[model samples]
Target: MRKALALSLCAVLLGGCASNPADRDISGTWINQVAIDAAAKGGPLREALQAYGPNLEWDVNTKAAQARYTNGFENVEGKLLGEKPGAWAVDFYGSSATELKRDGKQLSQAASENEPEQVFDRAVIPVPEGAPIGASFERALYSAYMGGSWQVVSGNGEGNTVQFQADGQVTGLPGADRYALCLAGDCASMSGGNDSIWLQQGGQGNSWIFARKGKTLEIFQSVNTALADEMPSYTAGDRKWLLEKQ
Candidate 1:
């Protein structure tokens, strides 16, 4: 009888070890924060605002929560969690469908209902296949003014550069209001100086320093000649025409 009891106890223990299903319910309004990992490829936010549509709402409390229309189709809500800056997870939820886990273990049926659900999608934005990830603001300015085919000519000693095209075409290097100067050796010297420079084609250039933190680039400059008058001046309303990375 002792041996029979031992066998029965082993069977019960094995039965208890079997895996159970998840029981967590994620149907409530969860507040989280979100950082801008990647800017949207299109001008959807601006278009939405201009069209008088529902603007994308980000959680004010959490630094990793965002809600926006995905590809002009379904509205996607994303949540990211991690201590490090870049590491994050996203959850894509449809209007009526149940939330799904993207990269985490599911809970057992006996799990508490208050347990947080694992994020479903890892990436914040669904990038198209073969899309370039990031671009500098200066590079973006080049492409916007000189078309997508323009190439960087050279980086002058100051915070200026020239760009050109293949067919012996010369395009002006557009100026930036606020320039983040990655100075060589000592960036401290360049800091707090409000100087500006003149770009003249085939002529000596002049120097001027930046004054404010958020100054706008008024005109395109070239070391060879003053291209400010040649190039079109961008205005506040022209910000809508800025190029976006896909």
Candidate 2:
């Protein structure tokens, strides 16, 4: 009887294992409609998205993940860990782990312990791959080129200091604490192709445009802010402020 009981227990365990669902494969570009919708209603994130353009795309595969923002110039990569529980997790090295729960065609991420979950929908249309040279402008390249303390080299804000943080925060630049770079655009040209780095201080309708360079940062204050309505344009003459990485 004891031998028969052991056999029954082993069968039950095997049955439970067989009933478990297979690990899901989440590999595609995801657009954050939750953030976009929230921005349309008005908020700090909205203002930032407006200035930077709401084109944040998450591209992931079985092993790697990337957060492409503002025309894909500001790109951040994370490691794609296999599915855990019912969700797939992306580990951003030392920063954070983003767990995405898939439901049909949508993936949802909890905004916080209390806030409503943010939703990401798989993109039917993917972001363009950009120019042939685009591959050279990865996040690591830009981070190494721009990250750290900087001092105004020659232009308007000469002698002033600023910082380009690894986490996207900008320090010491007046009326701005965050930055986004736009290098390419979608087929519709709705979000990017501005070829400018946008900076937002706080509140709606307030922003700054800076031309990105190798070691120097150029600010174009004279450029008309009204251009935010259409394609933004700025000439070399508009750039009078500069900062050199220290």
Candidate 3:
């Protein structure tokens, strides 16, 4: 019973943050900014976030919060337990509760005595549009196959590194911060049953597609998504793009 209670506590805590009062409503989209910035500089936390997937996001409403991950999302409806010394206490499962404190656009969650508090900020979330057919399965495969570090083999930025996260987050890729299994509604027919991935500058910036081999990734400049026939290939000169799993 104690183990089950502990698991329930973890589930509720990971679910998200919540609050009431219009002036202090902790509603909207929230992302772990600290984890993201730390992951970019490379360290133990980076590796951990990479393995855990960096696109962790939360959608908090007045009385509920939803935590989104690569595999999926979980929602936890909170009940107003009571008022704490400096925050609002919300109970998710019996005695397991989280305290929420909101200030402006930022929301802070009080942690246990040994754990550091977590902070989240209000932010806009980009919507992925034109999802291709079989995107779910393709996304799952992409997440499973691309979750690791890759070393650039022959690109202009040789010796650099890139990490493909299961949650669509990409790190150490020049001009790209996110990735997708398929976007622009053109990947299904273009892939020809082969594994492919897309790298985007920002969520809405220019994107390039790459075909994946066993342990190698190759990008063709001419096959960009801007044009219908655009597909990445092993081109010469500056367009020579390749990555090998490290």
Best model number under lDDT: 3
Could you report the Cα RMSD, in angstroms, for every candidate shown? 17.1, 15.1, 15.6
For candidate 3, the lDDT comes to 0.53
Predicted candidate 3 versus true structure: per-residue lDDT over 40-88, tens digit per residue: 3332322333343323444555554422212122334556554455466
lDDT of 2 by residue, 83-133 (tens): 777777766678666676677777666454433455666654322365221
Local distance difference test values of all predictions, in order: 0.27, 0.53, 0.53
Q: List pairs with backbone clashes in candidate 3.
A: 220-232, 220-233, 223-230, 223-231
Which candidate do you rate higher for lDDT, 1 or 3? 3
Assess candidate 3 and give its TM-score to the true structure.
0.39
Q: Model 2 clash pairs?
A: none
TM-score: model 2 vs. ground truth = 0.38
Worst 10 residues of 3 by lDDT: 66-75
Cα lDDT for residue 34, candidate 1: 14
| Cα distance off (Å), candidate 1, residue 146 | 30
